[model samples]
Target: MKVLIITGGNIDDDFASSFLKKNHYDEIIAVDGGLAFADRSDLSITYLVGDFDTIDRTILEKYIHRPDICVHQFIPEKDYTDTDIAVKLALSLIKNHHSEENEEKVIHILGGTGSRLDHVLANLQMLKNILDEDVRGIIIDRNNIIEMIRGERVLKREEMTGTYVSLIPVTMELTGITLSGFKYPLENASSHFGESLMVSNELLEEEGRIFIKEGMAWMIISKD
Candidate 1:
């Protein structure tokens, strides 16, 4: 299914509402404070998952009585973040369920980045976990769209929404990296931690392509 996971993190109403309106989602899972965002944005949530720790009791009670919304409440002291649990559940649902459109299962994350740097990093790391399920996970904020990429990929310039595109090694050493259609293109370059060798690159023409022989990269496409 084409599922959108909303996490209890930093969310801008204008951005979230616009994005939610633009996408075609079969289901929207609200995690904790995400419920508030969803309510404020006037978006209907298919499932609600979290400890209810951050949500208002009155709002939670109202949703509890709604037959249309499936609620899963977890304990406050769990090891996994509410976002993590929601993602795993979404993966399972995607694997077992079919989508209206015959395409790959994908998850778009909303309200996942901001103030909490640790949560932001954890959410970024979760992108790989989501992708491992053969489901594409992308974190969309007002400034950027972050995606975890594996193997060879082509990003058409016209398909890009941001002004700058950066590639960061997700592995210890992402080797044999090649870039085309970018102002500062690279060929057979290797990037490792301790250095952001690949960042702030712009597309030179109608398309930008990336070829990775081994390992993975976190591709950040930003507007500002």
Candidate 2:
């Protein structure tokens, strides 16, 4: 099942609307300010959640009484972000809607990658929370699509969504990391934290592969 979560951020409305229209989502969530963005995207929110702090009062009032939307309100003193709670809801839905063997539940987060670095980072870290439950989390923006891959990942050049594929180290060190069909190929390469040698890579052939024996890697696909 594909669950789409929208969070408070300075998102590109046109890009977001286009993305929402193109993809089919099984579940849609609005996290506070995302309620306004969801309204702009012409999408009906299945679950509206958050502390209701950052969203517009008028927008909140408009949807607060809607019968179609399931609203989950929280206090401002809560520890978890709206996106975090939304992820939890999506996971719960997966458990009820899918079979026990359904481990491929994907959560695509939109409108959460904005100028606020702290919030953006927090949203990205939410992927770890999702992964812990054996689910996939992807953060999407106008210029970038980000995901964390701990094991091996295979890709086809033509299947890529952006102009560049960058791998960032999230752990202390990653060993036995091999890159094939890349402009700058590596064989059994090892990297420590804060390494830039693996960034901005392009595929040389039709197929590409990233083999990681240990540690975590965050892959960022970005356009020029």
**CA RMSD of each candidate after superposition:** 1.5, 1.7
lDDT of 2 by residue, 1-224 (tens): 88999888877887877777778888899999988888766787789999999898988998888999999999999888888899899989876784546446888998778878998888877787787777778999899989888878888976787889899988889999999988988899999789997999988889999998988888898997
Model 1 over residues 70-181: C-alpha lDDT tens digits? 8888899999999999988888888889556658678999988988899899999999998788778999988999999988878897688889999988889888899998
The residue ranges of model 2 lying beyond 4 angstroms of the native Cα positions read: 99-103
Candidate with best TM-score:
1
Clashes of each: 0, 0
Scored against the true structure, residue 57 in model 1 reaches a CA lDDT of 83
- The 10-residue segment with the lowest total lDDT in model 1: 97-106
lDDT of each: 0.87, 0.86
Best by lDDT: 1
* CA lDDT for candidate 1: 0.87
* Ten contiguous residues with the weakest lDDT in model 2: 95-104
TM-scores for every candidate against the unseen true structure: 0.95, 0.93
